[model samples]
Target: MAIARTWKSHSVLPGFGLALGFTILYLSLIVLIPLSATFIKSAELSLGEFWAVVTAPRALASYRLSFGAAAIGALLNAGFGLLTAWILVRYTFPGKRLVDAFVDLPFALPTAVAGIALTAVYAPNGWLGQWLEPLGIKVAFTPLGVVVALTFIGLPFVVRTVQPVLEDLEAEIEEAAACLGANRWQTFARVLLPALWPALITGFALAFARAVGEYGSVVFIAGNMPMISEISPLLIITKLEQHEYAGATAIAVVMLVASFALLLVINSLQWWVSHRHGRKQ
Candidate 1:
């Protein structure tokens, strides 16, 4: 006798259709509609106007500063984050728990508060800044300050992303590599890196994305100087304050498109790495 196919066998969750509908509805209301409105508002400008708005000297400068600083900050976080995860996972020490807890401080701290604190610490008359200024280094109210703020907030993304993966990884793999005559660098590059590469990419992408859209912490440290330290998000706010809604939307659209494109590239890289690794297995 023939048996009937059941929905329960295909899906663990009951009401799959209902769940799918709700998912789409929720996304439409929360994400799609708002994004659609941004596109529509930006369309108010002529194509030439849109191009001019997004490509103005000030806009280009802001784009460079924003994307460049974010990329630098994310890259910094990736290396240090990997090191931190390795230490946290592979070693036991006093204050380990406290250090782990401190990693989440940026998430819990208010963005404005974090900005103020960083500013105070890095300001000319402030603690670290007072020492650094005499040596010709400036942190507060500069492009470097933007980078510092981005790095501060973005660190947690990288650390948290790699931590769980590091925890699940077995130390025996390293021991086996060493037994096979691999040195420390060789073991890490040949053995550990392959396992950690995907997680590292994910963390980098998260940090980059977070830093790209960041406003609060960057604004205070960036000095709000047009074409100098101003970020794209801050530029958008400036346009809005001037009641140039179309201009603001135009900048927003550029940021959204660029962010989406970069993220897509990162995710594609991740998928390719995973696929290549799976084939090796």
Candidate 2:
């Protein structure tokens, strides 16, 4: 009994029970309570009514665009963000700090401001827009514009997620692989990739989640065209404006469920990859 008391007093962090209780209470008050209210609001609709609200043609189109654009944005970020992080970590050049700072501009910029700036730059009469219009490319006020806006906002998530991982990795690993008669591609594919997989997956998931829930950054570029460029979040807001509270809550619930499901899958994948890599090492 004396030993048990000593061990308990010497624990690395005291009051685990207090901390756990506080965490549960905080989450319940801030997250669980609000989410439960959404379901309660939505439950006013009958089963068929709820089904129709979610499955309506307009809602379906919004779902497609929101998820599709978010996926595309996340994918593009996963590629370019990795490259950005690599360059920052692996090389030194003129204005390197400037470039690094620029990577985070999106995070600091307001979403509405981002949407407006992108619209101006991509509008048909604007700077790059004038040059691209003749090439049959339209960005402002279109679905493509939505993708651009999402990509802009989501880039930071990927870069920030992977940057630390890349920094922690030693460049000598690549040199070692080369000394073993491995080609560059082989070195990267077999040596660097496995270590980077978990971080990349996490970055992708973060960017994807951010893009899915994004509204202000997309609304201006999307042109708010129903069934074409409208996003689900925008649709929910519209329903709320129209006093269709139940419908709005229903849509919100669907988004909540779907986002949770996708995040869960991505997190599971990250865990599996990390576990496998650990076993191999």
How do the residues 135-201 of candidate 1 rate in per-residue lDDT, one tens digit apiece? 9999999999999999999999989999998888798988999999999999998788888888899
Residue 133, model 1: lDDT of: 100
Error of 1 at 273 (Å): 1.0
lDDT of 2 by residue, 1-281 (tens): 12455534656887988987999999999999999999999999999999999999999999999999999999999999999999999999999999999999999999999999999999999999999999999999999999999999999899998999888888899999999999999998898888899999999999999999999989989999999999999999999999999999999999999999999999999999977873465
lDDT values for all models:
0.93, 0.94
Backbone collisions counted per model: 0, 0
Clashing pairs in 2: none
- Candidate that scores best on lDDT: 2
Error of 2 at 97 (Å): 1.2
List TM-score per model, in order: 0.93, 0.94
**TM-score of predicted structure 2:** 0.94
